[model samples]
Target: MVLLDMNGTFLFGGDRFGPNQDYASTYRALGGSRLATDVVQTIIQTCFDTLEVIYNDPTRSDSFPQVVDTLRALPAARGVPPADLALLERVIAQHELGRVPDDYAVSLQKLARSHVLGVIANLLSRKDPWLQEFYRAGVLDLFAVTVFPRMVPASSHRGSSSTKQSVRWGSRAPM
Candidate 1:
C-alpha cells in the first residue's frame, strides 16, 4: 500500500489567498456581481483571516469550522443572504480544490495496477467536491482507501502512541 498527501502531491492549488490571488474576479464569476468588489474582497479576506487564525492555533485544529459557517457568523456577512453565503462557500472551494491534469490521472491508473493507492488529505470542506473531482479526473476508483482527516496540530500528535500506531497501521480517519 502507498500513502500520499493530496495537496501539492497529485492535487494542486488548494491554498487560498496567495500573492497572485484575485478575489474580486472570482467573486464576480461566481454570481457575486450584486455585491461591490471591495465588499466581496473584504468578505473573502475575512474568511482567509479567520482560517489563518484557526490554522495557526493548535487548540482550534480539532474543531476547525467550515468556511461557510464562519462566513455566516461574520458581521460583514450579516447583510448577505443565505444564497450568497452558499455562493461564497463555492468560491472558496474553487480556490482551495485545485484541478487534476489528464496525465496525472493516467499515471495514477498505471500505478494503481501494481500498488494499492490511498489518499490521506487534510481538507477544510466536505469530501464530496474532492470525490467529484477525482471522478472527473477518472481516478476516483484508483484509490482503495481515502482518509480526509481534520487538520491535526503538530504539537498534539508529537510522539503520541496513537500517532505512532496510526503510522504503523492506517486508520480510516473521518473527513
Candidate 2:
C-alpha cells in the first residue's frame, strides 16, 4: 500500500511556494517588494490554474511538458534569471521527478513492516536534476517508483496534475 501527503506531500500548494515567512525572502531575492500573502497566493494559483487548463485539454495527450513551460513563463517567476529559475525548478523537479516526503519512512515501517511505497506528485517542472535533490534528501530509498513530470505521460491516471493515491493498511488507534 502507498500513502501520500496532502498539498506539498501529494499535491502542491501551501507554504511550499511562498505565501508565508519564506515569501519575503523569495520576493526580495527576486528583486520585489514585500508582497502580501494574497499576491504570493495569486502567483501560485495562476500557475496551477494554467496547468489545469493545459492538462484538462482534450486535444493534448501530453500535459506535463506544457505545465513546465507555463510555470517557467509565469510573470511572477520571470526576471528571476536562468540561474534562480534553475534553483526553483530544482525544487519542483525534486517532487515531480523524484520521491515523496521524508516522513513516509515511519508510515511504511508500520505497514507490512516491510511494505514498499512511492510518490506521484503533480508538479510544474520536468527535469532530472529535480529528482537528484530528492535523493540528496533521502527520499529515494523507501519508494520503488518516483513518478514526476515528463516521466509519465499526461493521461487520466498519470501526469503533472495528478492526485495522491491513498493506501489504507489495517486500522489502528487514532492519533
lDDT of 2 by residue, 1-175 (tens): 4644324453232225323334334444555444454554455556656665766676553534444456578988665555544444443333234344545534444552455565555445553444454456544455555554334434434433443222222233212
Model 1 Cα shift for residue 115 (angstroms): 1.2
Model 1 misplacement above 4 A:
151-175
Model 2, which residues run further than 4 Å from truth? 1-24, 27-45, 56-61, 66-68, 71-80, 87-104, 126-139, 149-175
Which candidate leads in lDDT? 1
Error of 2 at 27 (Å): 4.6
List, in order, the clash count of every candidate structure: 1, 5
Residue 60 in model 1: shift from native, Å?
A: 1.8
Candidate 2: Cα lDDT at 92: 38
Model 1 steric clash pairs: 14-96
- Per-residue lDDT tens digits for candidate 1, residues 68-135, read 77888888888898888887887777777876788888988899878878888766665678889988
